[model samples]
Target: MLATTHPQSGMVATSRIHRVVTGNGGAAPSRGDTVELTVSHLTKRYGETLALSDASVTFKPGIHTILGENGSGKSTMLKILSGVVSPSEGTIALNGRAISPRTPHDMHELGLSTVFQEVLIAPHRTVVENIFLGYDGPLRRRIEKSARAPLAQALLAEISRFPIPLSAPAGELPLASQQLIVLARALVRLPSILLLDEATAALDYADRDLVFDAIENYAAAGNIVIFISHRLEEVRRLSDRVTVLRSGHIVETLERDGITAERLLKLMAPEAAIHA
Candidate 1:
């Protein structure tokens, strides 16, 4: 009970705390040591509808916001990231290895995960079933249903900061809650990279904030997060870096310090930088 007791130690013991310091006081994420995914010169085109064009980006361990208006090809970029669709031209690297995902199944095998704008959970199934919907006789090699619910709960707990009712039907939940469900499902794979395509469009301000907060955490854990959002204000607030896409081409990539709502809008404006 002395003043200098170790149990209630003063600044001396507290000062010995183990703080995780980056290479330079965490000023920037250490890309060389911590990058999870790399995308270079990616282009996607479907029968003359150019979705992306020569887009090159490196996703470090941080949340990156893709800023674009509708039809700006942001969704195309997300789809490419998740391997939901093939790119006309580009290279993607996961875990420092190059991979060009030609199919959704291929990307999943490579640890590239995503949640699209639309929710696709089975309406009649329970949350547990929804989580394990794909893990059946084919994928899991006879994984029993009895063992799936607890496993789903564990997976949910890994990424979710709050308690989710495992018994509820995912389709019955509100839009925001269902969005969370999709996010949780993607995280179940414990992927090295994550892609979000307008996942927060239906969310209110508070719910959007909650999801973005989770995104920050996910990125901090050394996972790459590629997010596309049409909400310019949210783009500025949530993204560590912003990539502006206009008509399938990356107009610019701005750091958090360099981007603003006015600047972003001006860059996206029809009168700002357009070639007819």
Candidate 2:
């Protein structure tokens, strides 16, 4: 297990930082615990509109941020990755093996879970019920019925300082609390690859910090987090690598050290940068 010190907090981040060295050079993945997710020539279209075009990037076990303005194909990339939508062209590979995820559940089974920007929850369901909703399948539940509440409570406590009642109807809770429930749902899956599409948008500062901490710790444990957010500060804080997209096309992929507001702006919108 490799221990890392957070640049901002100066806290020793520990657990296990799993890394894999690629051609671009990063760290080597530990014995038997390596993951490399590659998207090759990924393209998506909605009738005449190209939402994503020839976008390709690789993600290892760390925080990878996707940045773009509205309609810049960030969500489309995530949608394809999360199996919410299929790519019109190209392929995705995990550990050098091709994978075509037909559904979100399929991606979940492949150790990828997504918390989309939309807070998806059953309004009438209890908080615990909402957290553990998808786990209860026709065949079996991921956690036993008795075990679900305790796990949900523990996860909630870990993610939020504000206490949410286990039995309270999720619809009655504030939007922040509801968003937390959706996050807990993804976290409970313990996915090797977690796709967060503006997952923290509804969170308050404190809760967002807590969630960021959780994300760091999760990545430290040899898992990959593919994050998409419009928040530049959040991107600067959490991104190990960043891919900038514009008008459905990938502009550039930057290493952590290369990330800068000016450079990112220039890459994302050259004409605007020129005018500015």
Candidate 3:
């Protein structure tokens, strides 16, 4: 969640999150297991523009939804978390140890992975090759077609209920299939923190359900899943907690019970009170 001082109250609205654990068919962690990630006093600047200012929030093992209008610092916050960019001023800690990631590879090594809003895939690459793009080490290497095919097929089956050809060129697949492939690429890593920036925007209804189920199972296994989406209904459905950002500041942090669309819209755009 983004952070700022209250306009009239002159107080910082620090987020107070309550964890509610549910069983994903008994795959979820035990109720008291700790998987805390804290981001405090984060700020990012680009030349004269301030993208994020004083954003602070703590994420635990659950599905967290980030809500904001365009330029409200949503993507900036995710980028900082995913290690695509460094925060101008702030700290990120897992449990109690402070850590900084300077690149996407570094972030992944620290148990963080991201699926961005854009569809990213090599057009000429086969689905299996694209899924295992960077994991070329000896133990996990897929230098041969026969070796990669089975593992890629298994992962694709686990994430998507629909059938996708593992041998098809990525460019030849539909947009929805390509989106699933992107998700497969990330899920193959089994990162502790999965950041999804509008990941489901390109998915069809069935594929969306498949992805949401995968998200639930991932979070259930004691990992953190942070996502941003404009679809309020999907947010309400998938989020265990929802954080609203506005103008580079956090407006509200709501638990599952508080995440009504009307209330969320009201908090997101307080100036449009009549419509809210």
Candidate 4:
């Protein structure tokens, strides 16, 4: 049984058998224990615009940061990985299996989840409903509202530092809180490859720390966390490896020990550095 205290009503909502990850026991390989995902020769073109050009990278079970300036194709690469857009060329492999995910649902079904900069939640729905949006079984079928609360509450508690009311409408909450809901929704899926595209852009200091802590814990549990942030400090603090992209091309892949804000900035904007 799953249960959580509703903030507004102080009532406990109960549920049973929540669908999280759709696999055997939903256990991912342990952290630092194996390679999880790989993207090879990825390219994306939007008419005459080449957003990402022949980019390739491998991800293991840890935090990996993607650093680049605007127009550097960082977002483009993330979009392809999240199945929001199809890559113009190249292939993706998950756990040694070549796979093509054509939609966000496809990616999630394959254990790839994403939280973008934009908060994508149904404002009018309760937080619990939003958290288990695409989940199979009872949650998706709307079989029993009582059976969804416990798992949703457990999942949210795992990722968020603050108390969130399971019964509150998401649209009524602040932007920061909505973003947290997005994170909660992603975590509930128990994805093997988690993509964060400027996910903390709207968060406050405390909220950001909470999100980071959740991310670290998630990665430690043997999953891949792909982070995209313009904040060099965040990249330095969270990344096990940093990949620099410039003008749609990969410039370098640096181990955590070798990553520095100055070096990353230089790689991200070579022309600016040269002028400076």
Alpha-carbon error at 8 in model 2, in Å? 18
CA lDDT, every model vs. true structure: 0.67, 0.81, 0.77, 0.78
Candidate 1 local lDDT, 1-276, one digit each (tens) = 001112222222100100111111211112232445778899988997888889987776567888777778888888878777888877888667888777877876665678888987887777876765544335443345555566566545544456678888888877766777777666555455678888878777766776677676556555567888777777877787888888888888888898788878876776753532
Tell me model 1's lDDT, rounded to 2 decimals: 0.67
Regions more than 4 Å wrong, model 4 = 1-35, 137-144
lDDT, candidate 2, 1-276, per-residue tens? 234454456665443212111111222222235677999999998999999999989998789999998999999999999998999999999989999998998887777889988889999999989987776557855455776676677677778997899999999999999999998887766667889999999988999999898888778666789999887889889998999999999999999999888888788788888888
CA-RMSD of model 3: 9.2
- Quote the positional error of residue 226 for candidate 4 in Å: 0.4
* Candidate 4 per-residue lDDT over residues 244-275, each given as its tens digit: 99999999999989998778878988778877
Task: Let me know the TM-score candidate 3 reaches against the reference structure.
Answer: 0.84
How many angstroms is residue 170 displaced in model 4 relative to the true structure, after the best TM-score fit? 0.7
Error of 3 at 117 (Å): 0.9
TM-score per prediction, in order, is 0.76, 0.87, 0.84, 0.84
Q: Who wins the TM-score comparison?
A: 2
Name the runs in model 3 displaced over 4 angstroms. 1-34, 138-147
Error of 2 at 178 (Å): 0.6
- What tens-digit string does per-residue lDDT give for candidate 3 at 1-276? 222233336554311111111111101112223457899999999998999999889998789999999999999999999888999999999877899989988877666779998999998999988887775554844245455666666667755667788888999999878888888777666566789999999877877887788787667556689989999999999998999999998887999999998898888887785654
Give the CA lDDT, 0 to 100, for residue 13 in model 3: 31
